[model samples]
Target chain A: MNKMKELSVNHLLGIKYISEEDIQLIFETADHFKEVINRPIKKVPSLRDVTIANLFFENSTRTRLSFELAEKRLSADVVNFSAASSSVKKGETLVDTVNNILSMKVDLVVMRHPNPGAGIFLSKNVNASIVNAGDGAHEHPTQALLDAFSIREKLGDVAGKKVVIVGDILHSRVALSNIFALQKLGASVKVCGPLTLMPKHIAHLGVEVEPNLDRALAWCDVANMLRVQNERMDNSYFPSTREYVQQYGLNLERLQKLNKEITIMHPGPINRGVEITSDVADSNQAIILNQVENGVAIRMAVLYLLASKIKNYD
Target chain B: MSQKQLLNSSEMTVTLQRLACQLVENHTTFQNSVLIGLQPRGVALAERLVEILKNDYDLTDVEFGKLDITFYRDDFRRSGKVLEANTTEIPFVVDGKRVIFIDDVLYTGRSINSALTALQSFGRPLEVELLCLIDRRFSRHLPIQPDYVGKHVDVINEEKVKVNWSEDNKENSVILIDE
Candidate 1:
């Protein structure tokens, strides 16, 4: 038997702390919680007295809902702060926001913000465990975890599997998340879009960058489509959405060109006919809904693990 | 294994021969007998028993198979269905064969429960019996028990048992621990 490579998943600054062993642990922990979630009680006493605050400075539906569900499933007391109503609108600093929240005796903080490294900065200012929900375009660790879990669960193993991520690579925290995750899970990752939308010097990020969508689509066992992220694109990521879709959109023809066995995945709120066609988006191979189910389980795993780590030492 | 036998290498070997003899006598209904090991601990114990049985008797064909219950686990997702499960294949048709499910320790029986759930995937066995290196008393969470035992001991609530084996020199022992 071949030796299994370990995964490490950490909740700190930078992507350095998460190893493959930690990824496996999170997936396993998430898998374990599926049963706990199915129960009539719908909760575990793992973090009975623990208090977790969902500190969102960005708008989201899947991430926010899943984090709250994950916390509730673990029996943790959850507090939420919508960024629009927070005192930060009153000229408060990030450190002051964190300090004020920490003073409230929260055990963990799950934050989403517009600027990259916002979660890292908040982590430095607090004693509570910090989970980066989505931090600008840098990375969404939880989303990455869920993506990897879905890929591994569906395709058996992601190691050495060819995976191509299409659409807005520059503005997507989902893209950054999938790249880190697929790479960690041993999948050969590729990112494809127009030259402008594709990351500059992208090969240095340990992924192949392709401008031709057809070649990238045929080369991968799994193709992850990223939404154009129009809301976050302050300036033109490319010349125009119509030209971008014409060149790179996953239409029925491109879908047929792909290997029938190659799975279609998207961390969705999909842009129909923009990144992918409706037919391809709703195809048999698309595991988008599965990703949503796994997201809650994955978040549940993150909470259980972080809580256990806290309890293990203290 | 009993505390004395676990500590005594010579005594451990004698009890092994005795357990093999008992298996041979009781499993007389089948022409061929196969030992299927559950993943992790069961695989090790099955490998151990095959050697002990072959050394004591002049058997021509004593078969061993590694059964990966990762896919068949009741709490597969929760148990974290790992990509690599040891492998669940008994090569021959297991129909009507007396099969021994070997494991290192018997606790809540969830592993055996998972193993039994897995065994149904292959051809049905005529009979299935449990064998363990250690029988942890008062932990019958599932409705499973070992037919053969090296030793039985009482375990406290806060205490756990760890069985360590050295494959290089073929040395195995037991350790009772608290965590």
Candidate 2:
């Protein structure tokens, strides 16, 4: 693919606009980083003394912890701005809050917000490197990276592999990011759920929208189970969690109907029996935990590359 | 020598055998010391060492491990197209075990650096050492050193050090070619 292996990581700041070659490099690099997770110190001084700011505009646990741990592992000084009860609401704009943080010489900014395009808007005004943790279901690029790393780790290379993402496609920034990443990495991706959750016209996003769970599960090499947003269930995704499980809960018998080597993955805060069963989630074939571990490595890579690339500019 | 250039297949094999001999002299203390190869070529070196150790000292009990340092590299963003890495199949503990990290060539030692990070995810280690096939002295960007070196040569940074397997590259030596 004539991969530009020599380009500075500054070239990869925006995940949504990345090329096929850049996506390939992230996966390959994650493989290298994954090997080092077993080390005694569990760190390398790649981005030593660099400062990274985590400006989470939304409430989170897994995504925040993942980026924080990733920054620490890369040896960057992290400045966290938790807006749980803070000044994001006191009539201050995202640009104003971001500009105040930028004035303090933040090397990179990792931001999450309920507003779509907030990260892009902030990045346009700031000189500091920007990574979208989650931008109102528009794109959560790093989450997608971890998902790719997890899928590739468990089922070999997910390229050309059939990955069925079942549940909440409309509100899943994860689903959007995964569709982009999986397609770039050569996975044949499909989104399956009730018509309410599955958007009608998303072929433009390069994924097949399958309404039938049985057919989707039958062909999937990796079944990525996303949490159905109960908040977004205002219309109808199905009757209820019990009904959904009965039809698509991925029980042992349902799991057995597909490939024995098929892997079941979930980004956590998992609903115990709704989208996935207890036995199925904990199965030897499941790599839900691997996704968590890979999350740190991917964020570390993203931050290190971004911060270091910015270093050459100044 | 200033004129040292591309090494042929036989030169690579003989040099590797000499490296094996040197490893025996330096590590004669531990009968239980483990030899772990970083994936691809590192394990190839380890396999060669096992055959040599068996023939010379008739020692076959020396344990070997394979490390796939895919997730441990620092400059992961610049690494090439990703593929499913070969599995890291270490079945023993590294804590208190005399461990030797082996690879094909030593340049910046970043791969070894990543391997060190990866080893910790498994268990602890008493001591870690390295054995490399070639030392490209001019290209070092880190303060790391190989415990055992096969051959030291001065090389340009723009050049590629291509190490071929037993079947390819005609023989088993290190070949230097321009980028």
Candidate 3:
């Protein structure tokens, strides 16, 4: 297949909306941006003329910071807005907030909303490109991209590799996006968590559901341990954290049982002792920090590619 | 379309040797000098020159790296086509060292302009020089000229100059295509 110079889609709303070639192109572009970030001077002037607005309708630490850093490293003008501080508290609509931001001539919008498909709703009404940072439990496209990138860096490639995502799959936009991204890149995916934490129709997505953590760890080449997302739990999904950890927590002892080495990944704000113990989380096999590092590069690739498509009306 | 051969294999080989000798004469041992190849096209020229310097002139410690200027170009959003980036593998710092940028052809001098900006990300160099195999005369849009030139050819804007390397499974020759 021929190499792609630009992304097939203007906005990275979800991994499912993108083609396999688009993922490959993003990876290749991220490879260059990764090198650029490691240099003595970490900034590029490619997006100097473009302006971006980050609208976070929900709480986030890494995703927001990663996107902002990615924009700053590309020399793009950035303005951040969080729902807590914004007029949304005074009953400002999503379209109104975004429209007001776009009125200032913003070229792109990087948004994380509590509601699913918020990015899609804004893209249809707005006049700029939109990147879905995380929309409820629907998709966190950049997070998934970085996770897959981290996997590719650890192993030679993602294809033909087995990946098992452990923990609250039903409440994780990361899990949904990761499944689509991994599957697109030719990797087999499995979800391992309590039946309550797992989506009912998740099997329709073509991922095997492994309830036992031990079997899931032994069967996979990489284990992406997800956060327990305590805030998203309106009702208790499991009996207790202790029970969940006893059954699902990946600790040092559990890691030693595996015959061959498997790469460990966590899109962070990791529960230190819940889904993964501190010993295993901080282990040599875990690429949690690398995933954070690759997040910037991956986001930069996304912003740069999308910004390139923002037409100059003048 | 029609094409005209600018330099054949024997002529190209002699030109390369002369260029290597000139580089060795100025930067002996190449200890404090680093060679940077502009990505995609310039890399082939830089690799060939480094090989000749190592084998024929016995300059074994020559430092070489590739730099991609796609991110530093001025025409980022101005152009319709998105610029594709190539590999950049600069392992050593360029601070306080004489750096030479090698490319296959110097046309509008825009690529060199972009290369200059891209190089600053590494470190500040003591001095910088441009070296190209073919210098397209009277067509430069920028006020830039190469310090070293293998051949100077007068060509119009519509025509193109292509340097074919034997490494790409083609005969080593420079062809000027008339479209």
What DockQ does candidate 2 have relative to the true complex? 0.16
**Per-residue error (Å), model 1, residue A257:** 3.2
Sorted on lDDT, highest at the top, how do the candidates line up?
3, 2, 1
After superposition, candidate 1 runs with Cα above 4 Å error: A1-16, A39-41, B1-179
Worst 10-residue lDDT window, candidate 2 chain A: A1-10
Worst 10 residues of 3 chain B by lDDT: B162-171
lDDT of 2 by residue, A175-222 (tens): 988898888888899888877777666788788888788888888888
Question: Cα deviation of A179 in candidate 1 (Å)?
Answer: 1.7
lDDT of 2 by residue, B1-179 (tens): 12225677777767767877777787773465889999867887788888778877767677889987654556543443322345577877777888999998898888888888778776778889988888888677777898888888787887767666784435666777775
**How many clashes in each candidate?**
15, 30, 0
TM-score of chain B taken alone, candidate 2: 0.88
The full ranking of all candidates by TM-score, starting with the best, is 3, 2, 1
Better of 2 and 3 by DockQ: 3
Interface RMSD of each: 10.7, 6.9, 3.3
Candidate 1 C-alpha error for residue B39, in Å? 13
Which scores better on DockQ, 1 or 3? 3
lDDT (10s digit) by residue, model 1, range B101-174: 88877888887887775566565788899988788898888888899998787887577777766774246567
- How does model 3 fare in lDDT? 0.93
